[model samples]
Target chain A: MKSVKAFAPATVANVSCGFDILGFAIDAMGDYVEVFRKEEPGLKVISIEDDGGKLPWEVEKNTCAVAIQAMLDDYGQEIGMDIALKKGLPLGSGMGSSAASAVAALVAANRLLGDPYERKDLLPFAIVAEKAACGAGHADNVAPSLLGGFVLIRDYHPLDVIKLHVPDSLYCTLLHPHFQLNTSDSRSVLRDAIPLKHSTIQSGNVAGFVSGLYQEDYELISRSMRDVIAEPYRAVLIPGFYEVREALKAAGALGMGISGSGPTLFALSKGAEKSKEIAKAAEEIYQNIGLGVDVYYSAINTRGAYVLEENK
Target chain B: MKSVKAFAPATVANVSCGFDILGFAIDAMGDYVEVFRKEEPGLKVISIEDDGGKLPWEVEKNTCAVAIQAMLDDYGQEIGMDIALKKGLPLGSGMGSSAASAVAALVAANRLLGDPYERKDLLPFAIVAEKAACGAGHADNVAPSLLGGFVLIRDYHPLDVIKLHVPDSLYCTLLHPHFQLNTSDSRSVLRDAIPLKHSTIQSGNVAGFVSGLYQEDYELISRSMRDVIAEPYRAVLIPGFYEVREALKAAGALGMGISGSGPTLFALSKGAEKSKEIAKAAEEIYQNIGLGVDVYYSAINTRGAYVLEENK
Candidate 1:
């Protein structure tokens, strides 16, 4: 059988009201995985580049390696394969770098192994690999990277995910401050219990946001996407979170909130022009503080992970 | 001008996971409102019947009268009209009887006054009337009754609402166990705080449900509609809640949950046969315990509130 190659885009988890259930892929930011059949009997990872010397080479610890290993384990005694990863996004940027690698590797491995597992079935394998990397089972990133478009993880058990339609008018601007905010640390700082009234408001917002997506009503979507529960507590970790959000809102962005954990804030706007303006304004705000920040303007990538090419 | 008559179906609030934000109207159960031009200089409510001798005669306190009063307040004077309300649905049965009366009256008044306010504008008036009735501002019932579909209330202030297209295959069965469950009392029993983990799960379920509606995936909708936070805590007030849910599920009902506060249980089914079976099983379960339950099997009402005949 011919070998294959695939690419999985980096995803933004939470998406405000969606929290662990919602995510979307970025078209221009992600990782690539290449898999080729070999006469050797043992699986091997050939190389991993641009990972800042942070990712481990060991199959169990490496996110992409572990994901490919899981696919091999399920399929049983597949021919040995040389796997290569080209990491495009930064590690620990709250941009789903690990999830992109995991999804890419699993997708490439699945394609190489005569596609033993269905596309949706690869989600758990990707999640397992992510758990090995992040030390937790978080599907927000992996689900979108694996399934593409906007994903809602309804239930983790039996692994149920729903892909939501992204409105064409919606554009995203991601501003990543050049500071690290570990997901583990950010999670530990959150309050164990939230006030009842606040939870009600949050639930209301979540419902509103979901309905907004269905109706394609950007105004209602903007009004409903406000998150009071996690963002309020997590915003303290971001240096210029409030100022950036205010500036984006003033520049005609529909809404703004923390992307994934902290340090990366995202805004949704109606048009490319407004989105670019918001992105430019956000960069200026970060620059005023003398902080380095990377900005990306893109639309939601509806296509998730797929086989990019097949070997002859 | 000749009198105009219209009926707005009563709605079930909460809708399980949504709690105070999600609601849908039920056919065959509602209040009828009639509006007519009168010789008097001020608006007057002629008759309000079927209140079980509990509602006040004062226009300021009655749900329908208060809604009409709101329309008048918005217009700066009475529109010189007479309004009559004939209530059919039982009061405090977790079926949003008061909201139906309020919405119906507002629709009638709006038409009589040449619709000085837009259709969406009447929502705030209905919500205000609801506050007068329940002592709180909630849009679950008002939004659905006013909009005539599955509605997600994005925000109450500056009033944002999104209407979703319900799948054609879905059928609803509602069983009201002749009892009262006040919204205020049910709300007061809840704990002052909730676990963050539970909140996250709730958010995931809501997102999943909305995605399911968009995709028209019944299986996903059923699996995602399960409510862990509110149902477990609130179901204790409803007699045989668990038993009825089990019975409905065993009878091939897609999903079942406590409709609104209590007493009323709702089930979603794929077809009329299953809906009837669910209704029958639920009624038998409650009847065995010496409770009289009224069951209604209907599809989603696409028309929210409308005039039966234009005023001549």
Candidate 2:
């Protein structure tokens, strides 16, 4: 595989209570990229499309370019690569749009370089690239884009990453309100202090969700995913957040919460049919609020990052 | 199988960062009780001993009696039984003294009642009984005593419980300094509100520990068991806590933290040699503080509440 093309799917971080540490991939929505090895000695940005004149093309500001540069820097081989990114997921949409691009570029670059780097080795580079784009080093988006399934960013220092088995019965319905919420702005709006009791409650939910994944207890997992700290405060910024969640719950959705930084809300359900119902209900709720909405029904992607296609 | 007597070991709650949600059993360091059916219309507290007259004999004030009564009240059965308490772990030692009595009595009673109820079925009863003793309904202790191993009490409502596999290479060393830190008093000292940044850090540690347990990464588990929110503030009351933890860590102990509330400190290690070293170092630290100390080395108890000896 001298040169290859890959698609890294967009992801939902925070999965309710698991902020900064937990994430899952969405298969249908993602970014596509292509890479080709060059005899020259430096990573070169070939082209970018569908960014709506928003993303930067510079090596420092471009997520794909930064990721490839980091990988080349780590490998100590100044092998050059021509990369192209077609951004499919919307930018700054709380849907891991940048992470998908960074992951896809790094994965394609790693393949172009005779597979010199392991997939896990690419996480930090992707995180760094994401940091350059979002101005924060959060693994919740990058981990899922890189490793698939439900990835737990155990510790960022030594980078302890664990792939969790998502239950087959679990399905997600994402409602993107067609609004942008910058991760930095959302983070800044959050309170600098939280009640200790609220923190304890959130921790309990996180533990329960992780354990529920292990036990395949959907009921427990849903009950445990409630977030009292970040979501309660962040939801204030997202229109129809509470109404959508309550409507979905009333419509038999198991659990619901803001996906990552907000403006994008997700509901967890027991099956595809229920997930569809949830999506329909969420779209209606958003429409009632006079906002455009894009809804996707997806299952937990077990495969993390992978090469979708290759060219000779 | 006509009659049975069982002993449920005591537990240490709040296992560091896992406040109100995590606990583990201590081997041979708990209350012992026996239960046998009698041909009577109501439950009876037959006898109590070795409790230093600290506990009440009235059924309402007795932890064991109240627990059994809750079960009886729920079932509305005319079953009667005799309960004997052999208090081995001292009261008010931050060692879950009340949880032990509740668990042992419930286990014995359940067995005497032909074991009709599942262990989880008895959790709410035990928690309610615990509230009668401690004035709060918390499961950090009761869950471990009932389930064994390291337990994460994810939620009280609908009961989200996750039991992580305890690694065999791990040894628990508990050092109880001669002092009393009432759970309520210790709880009162805590600031009702905490800085949100600190809570986020603590939540990260919780996520790291849970992920570590799932991956069976012992080093990460030890590194991630840190408690920044509660430990610093609470450790001030426990004399020499800082010195003991420092010495143990210096002597190659994996990690150390206040066992439950305070006064009793615990450490985790891989080898028996290191566990002994930690215990010895802790003893020296406590001695330097002019406090009496008792140390115990044990592994995670997989068998939670069980019958110890049956009277044929």
Candidate 3:
């Protein structure tokens, strides 16, 4: 095939207790990347669409282009690609927009290049390329975006990623504000160090959250989906944070936390109807403050990254 | 039945990555508590066996008597018991000495009280009584000792406890030095505050370990069984810890960390034979330092607390 177009979904990283280590994919939003063969060996970004913020046009600077570059560099066969990224997800709203772009581009490139590797095998290249968007090399958002459903980043050094099971009945509700909270700024506000006690408590919650998922215990998930470290620190940055959280909880959200860096809050529940109820309550809280917010209800996206179109 | 006798296994709390939240039971050592009915409604510690140090015989102060008291106080049915403790595990050796006693006494009392509660139900009484052994009311050690296998302490306030799975092939090798590192002293050395990075990494490891258990991925469990919180501070108190850790790793051990708040180092391996090799290497390290050490190789215990004698 001369060209391929693929999409990768936005993911909820941190999952409350599992900061930098856990995430899950949702069907609500995503980004699409189209890759076309270039005559000579190189990578370039030919076009960008629906970008709320100024994204890099240069091949080396853009997440999508950089991801394609990494893939081409690793390919033993001669390859060149021109890329296009269409951002269907909100930028800097913690919905993993750049991650979607990074993952999508790598997937498209791999598709047109005779599919040299498995989708999961593309993780390393995707993670390295995602660093172009976020300064830190973290897989919480990227892994789930690539692998689908829920993923746990066991270790970072040697880079171990494990795909975890997500209950079929699980539902996700996301409320995104019109404004943006840059990933860098959201991370900068977090404490460099946390108290040992807080860490211990957070550890319990993370383990509990995982166990809840396995047992399909909604009560356990709701109780354990607490973020003692990041949420406490970043909650102040999001407007009407506490009120929205209370509203979500009151409306039967299993748990709620900052989706990515904030200006967006993601709440999870059991049924789609219940999740909508939670979404309405949470959105109303943000809307009461005269904020334009977008609420999306989703069942988890089990497919991580996939091809949408191909030209043979 | 006028009296009952039961035994509760010793447990390794913290489990390296899961400080204050995770633990597992092994088949190595335990504590046996025999409870006899008292004429009136009052608790007493009549005698203690295998006392490594002078233990409080007072009903209000001793761990065994205190656990029995808590159980009786919770029961609406009039119940009184005089207790005797046999500490098969070494006291103050980082082998959950007090937790074993606390769990055993609670089990024996519960058994003699006509099994008023389930094995898991006895957790609260054991946790409350464990405070007499260690200042803080934590259940990492006691829960696994009471429930058997591995356990996750999700929350302590409302008292949420979950029993987790353990791989049958996983083997535990513990090398306990003939020295006392009191729980109070061991805990006192820990830093009250830790860096956020450390906490996040530790959280990942804890979640990873739990995932490992479910997946039956020994490599992941070993890699994730890291203790960034407690082991660092307490490692200094133990003799020849580093050498033993290296030796164990070289001998095909998956991971090694301070068992509870050491003097005893716990190492895990893929099989019984490998665990024995790891145990030999660890033991030799302490022996070379002229410190007497006892090595116990065991599989994960599936049984929690069990009755030895009941005349019902």
Candidate 4:
């Protein structure tokens, strides 16, 4: 195929208690990328469709460019491609915006290259692209966006990934505050070291949270939802964070926390009715603090990145 | 009922990846305690029938005394009781020796009191007794001993416990080195602070480990079987821990790790035949180092602590 188009769904990483290891895809918004073959033997960014916004146009600085370049190097192929990006998610809103672009581009490029590798085989390339957008090469966001459903990055050295289970009754409500907190600054606010006691508690929560998901126990999930490592320090970056969490809880959210890194807050519930209440409560709290927020309610996204169209 | 007798099983804590949070009961051996009610309003240790070894006869210093005392205080009863103890496991062997005694005593006392509460209602008293032994209150040892099977203590403040699933085919092989390491001394060897990077990696392992148990994925469990927090520091205290671990791995054991702190090393296999081979390999390694060791084999204990006899 000479041209291909793909869509990559947005993913929510960290999942309250699981810090850097857990993530799940959300269906509200995502990014779309198109790749077209060219005679010029290099990757190029044709356009970035946004609302009068400017991003790095240089191929070396863009997420999709770096990821595709890495994949080409590994496959030992030199092919020219022009890429276009359409941002359906707000940049730096903590909804895995960067990861969506990187994943969508890789999926598109793979199709344009005649599908040399399987879908799961493209994670390494996607992760390298994520590193270009953020400083660290974390797969929590990318894996779910690429593979769909709930996913766990068990280890990073060899890039191990495990697809996790999520119940059908579970629903999510995300409130994105109309402000920006980029990935680098969001990560910088966290402490490098933590007490052993805190880590133990965090580990306990991680175990309980994952076990709860498998058992379809909502109460267990609510009780296990906690973050002592980064949430305490990063709470100050988002305005009205504490009050919003309290409101979310008061509205009967099974669990709630910062959705990726900040600017976006998410609460989970066992049903759609409670999910709507959680979103309304959070939005009202943000409005009371003189801030406008965009709310998105969704069931867990089962489909991840996918090829939209291909032409030979 | 004027008298009640109960037996509490031995518990293996930590389970490699989850420190201070995960544990499971073993069927090989346990502690037996009997409580006889009297008209006099005081709790006392009347007899400790062991291998001619004397324990503290005083109530304040003993874990069984502290646990039963707490239970009595909560019940608002000052009934006098004569308590007899029988130790089936060695002390400081990392088999949760002290926890077995405490859990047995609590179960016996509750039975004698006409079953004032359910099985799980006794965790607080059991945990208070564990504090007397470890100097810090933890339920990883006591919960599994009291509730049976695999249990996860998600939080300590409110005492949240979640029972995890264990595959029916999984069996345990433990080699207790002929040495002792006190809980406090084992804890003292560990550092108070950990880098966030290590904790994140550890969290991944914890998530994977629990998920593996529920899915019956032995390969995932083995891959996630790692201890970055306590094992490295405490291994120095055990004489041939590294060589024994290597031997366990060489013998095709699914996973091998410290039983709680040190000295006792446990390996897991899918069935009894492979379990015996794992035990043999570990024992052979310790014998080559000129050290004598005690070995035990068991399937995961489904029944935790139980009333042996209820004399009404």
Candidate 5:
């Protein structure tokens, strides 16, 4: 293929009791990348759109360009390519905006280079791009966005990632308030240590949540979606967090928590219809607080990054 | 049934990353309790055997009598019962010795009282008995000894207990060194708080281990059997712990860790022959250290507490 356009979905990481370990993809919003072959034996960023000119265009600084460079470095080949990124996800929304950009670019570049690597093998490249965008190279977001479905990063030293079973009817409602919460500020609020009592409870919930997914037991899932490590400290950063959580619980959400780091919140339900109801209920809390909120509700995206169009 | 005899299997608790939440029963050794009717409407410990005269005869102090008392109180019936205990497990060997006694007593009393409660419903009474034996009312041991298979005490406040899927070929090898580690001393060594980094890794392993069991992925189970919370600090209490662990790993054991607190170490292997091999490899390490050890290898006990004989 001389040129290819690929799409990658947004994702939610640190899912309730699964902090730093679990993440899942949502189908409602995503980013797209287009790559074209060029005569020059190097990569170039030709254009960018929908990012308010805030995203870096320099190949060394941008997430998409960095991911392509990593892939090229590993392949040990110099291939000419011109890239264009169209960002559909909002910046600093804690919805994995950078992960989507990196994943979309990797998919497009891989397709343009004769598809040398399998889909799952592209994760390390995306993680390097994440490090370029943010300071940490974490895979909770990139794994699900690349592999689709629910993903658990079991170990980090040798990088063992597993795709988990998702319930058929699981739906998500995401509410993003128009405010930027710096990831560094959110990390600062957390303590370096947590009580052993809390850690035991948190691990129990993690085990229970995984079991509930395999058994498809909704009640067990509801009871197990508790966060004791980070939420208690970071909830204050988001306005009306408790009120929004109570409203979502009343609207029949199986569980609700801050998606990624706050300013954005997510609630999970059994079906799309209930997800809509939960969105409406949760929106009122933000509305009463006088904050402009954007809401999206959809089923989980089981197909992570995929080709949109190709020119042969 | 006027007179009934029940047997409850010994258990291995704090299974690696599942400290304070996960446990499983072993079929090779257990405790038996016999309950018979008496004229007076009260509970009494008529005799105790095979305990080296260390167990208490008082109804209030004994685990068997306390569990029967709690059951009778909850049943709101003035039933008279005389209990006889036969112990097969060593005391304070970190093998759920008290849990077996409590479970066996509860099973026998429930049958002698015409079977008012289901097998799972007797967990709380066992917990109360555990509190009477030890200071804490934790269920990691008693729950598995009563309910069978692998058990996760997901939540303690409302007592959410779940029976997890056990891989059919999983085998256990337990090694008890001839030394006692007091539960209080074992607990006192643990800090009230753990580093957030360690807790996150621990929780990741917890989720991965549960998923491994459900998926029947033995390699994943082997990879996720890490315990960063308790093992590092507690290993010093047991002599030759590190050496035994290395030997088991060399013998193709999937994982190894302290069973409950210390002194008793357990290794998990994929099959019976491998478990026997692991047991032999582990026993040699203690022998070189001039310490006596007891070794037992068995399949997981899926049928927990059961009636052995009844006189109607």
Candidate 6:
């Protein structure tokens, strides 16, 4: 194919008890990337759209360009490629915007190279792009975006990413308040040392949550979706955080927690209707705080990144 | 029935990554308790056997007697009961010996009182018995001993115990070297606070381990069977721990870890043959150290405590 266009879903990481380990993909919003093969021996970003002029225009700084470059370096190909990125997810919203961009680009580039690598094999390249984007090659977001569905990053040294079972009727609600919590600032609010008691509780919840998924027990999932390590400290950075959580809980969300860091929150429920209701409740809370909110409801996405279009 | 005799299986707690929360019952060694209804309105310990005469004979301090008393107190029964205890498991062997005694006693007393409470309802009584015996009501041992199979003690305050899926072919090998590490001394060696980095790794292993159990993926189970928090410090308490772990791994054991405290070690393998081999390897390691060791091999026990006999 002369050209390829791909889509990668957004993801919710630090999923309550699964901080730094668990994440899931959402079907509501994502990023799209189109890569064009060129005869000229160079790589460049031809255009970027819907980024509100905040994303970098330079090729080395952009997630898509960096991801494609990583793929090209590993493939040892001197071929030229032009890239176009369209952002459906908001930047700095804890919706895995950068990861989606990088994953989408890698998906397109791999297809344009005549499928040199399988989908799961593209993770390292995506991690390289993540390192270029956020100073840490965290696979929590990138793995789900690339592999789809629920993912557990079992280990990092060798990059073990496991795809876990997702209940059929599970739905997610994302509420992004109109503000920004820098990832570094959000991380700085966390304690470097945690009590062993809290660690044990967190492990129990993690085990319970995973068990609930396999058993398809929604009540167990709700009871297990608690974040003792990060949410308590990060909640203080977001206005009306606890109130919004209570509102979501009252509105029938199974559980709610900070999606990635702050300024955006996510919840889970049994059906799309309950998810929508939760979104409405969260929107009202953000509205009461005099901040606009963007809400999206979706079932858990089982398909991660895919080729949207191809040209002969 | 005027008298009832019951048996409770032994258990291996901590199960690697699930320290303070996870355990599984084994079908090998256990404790037996026989409760006889009497005319007077008091509780008494009539006989004890196979306990090396070290076990307390007083009704107040004995585990079986204490457990039966807790059940009677909760049942609000003004009846006399004579308890006969027989120990199949060693004392201070890290094999849930005390828990087995308490569970066996509770099972017998429950049957003698016509079973007002279901089997699972006996957990709190078992915890009370544990508190009387060890000064803390830790449920990792008692939960599996009472509920059977694998269990997760998800919460302590409300005392939530969850039964987990145990792979049908899973077998256990227990190696008890000739020594005793006091539970309090083993606990005192652990750090009260752990770095957040270690906690995250621990949570990842716990989630992966549960997922592996449900999926029945033995390779994943082996990979996830790691204890970063407790094993590092506790390994020093047991001589030749690291070498024995390597031998178990080489002998095709899926994973190995300290049973509950120290001196006793447990390894999990897929089949009976592999479990026996692992046991042999562990035995050689302890024998070379000039210590006599006791080894038991059995499949995962699905039935916890049961009535072995009844008299009319």
Task: Give me the candidate number with maximum DockQ.
Answer: 5
Of all native A–B interface contacts, model 1 reproduces a fraction of 0.80
- lDDT at A266 for candidate 2? 80
**Tens-place lDDT digits, model 3, residues B134-250:** 777888889999889999998888888999888889999998888877777888999889988898789888888888888898988888988888888888888777777888899
Candidate 6 per-residue C-alpha lDDT over B1-312 given as tens digits, one digit per residue, 9 for 90 to 100: 399999999999999999999999999889999999999988899999999999998989999888888888888878899999999999988899999999999999898888899999999989988999888899999999998999998888787788989898899999999887999989998999999999999999999899988999898899999999999999999988888899889999999999988669999999999999988887888888778898889999998989999997
Give the candidates in order of lDDT, highest first. 5, 6, 4, 3, 2, 1
> How many angstroms is residue B310 displaced in model 3 relative to the true structure, after the best TM-score fit?
0.7
iRMS (Å) per candidate? 1.6, 1.8, 0.9, 0.6, 0.6, 0.5
Q: In model 1, which residue pairs have backbone atoms overlapping below 3 Å?
A: B148-B304
Encode model 5's per-residue lDDT on B236-312: one tens digit a residue. 88888888898889999899999999679998889999999988886788789889999999999998989999997
**Cα error of candidate 4 at position B292, Å:** 0.6
**Which lDDT tens digits does candidate 1 get at residues B1-312?**
668787888787777666666788766578888988887766667887887777766777878878888888888975677778888878877777888888888888788777788888888889889899888768888888888877777566667677777888778899988777766667767878889878877777776776677788888778877776678877888777788888889988888887777668888888777888888888788877788889998877768877766667
Alpha-carbon RMSD to native, per candidate: 2.1, 3.1, 1.8, 2.0, 1.2, 1.2
TM-score: model 2 vs. ground truth: 0.90
Arrange candidates, best DockQ first: 5, 6, 4, 3, 1, 2
TM-scores of the models, in the given order?
0.95, 0.90, 0.96, 0.95, 0.98, 0.98
> Which of the two candidates, 4 or 6, achieves a greater TM-score against the reference?
6
Scored against the true structure, residue B1 in model 6 reaches a CA lDDT of: 37
DockQ-based class of model 2:
medium
lDDT of 4 by residue, B221-306 (tens): 88999989999998888898888888988888888899998678889887888898898897789889999899988899988999
DockQ of 4: 0.88
- Return the TM-score for candidate 4, rounded to 2 decimals: 0.95
Comparing 2 and 4 on TM-score, the stronger one: 4
Query: Candidate 4 on A1-312: residue-level lDDT in tens?
Result: 379999999888998898989899987779999999999899999899972475677899888888889889988979999989988888878888889999999999988888898888999998888888888788989999999888999998888899888988999999999887876778899888999999998999989999989999999999889999988878898898888888899999998888888779888999988899888898789889999999988888887999998877
Better of 5 and 6 by DockQ: 5
- Residue A118, model 3: Cα distance from true site in angstroms: 2.8
Model 5 residue A301 lDDT? 97
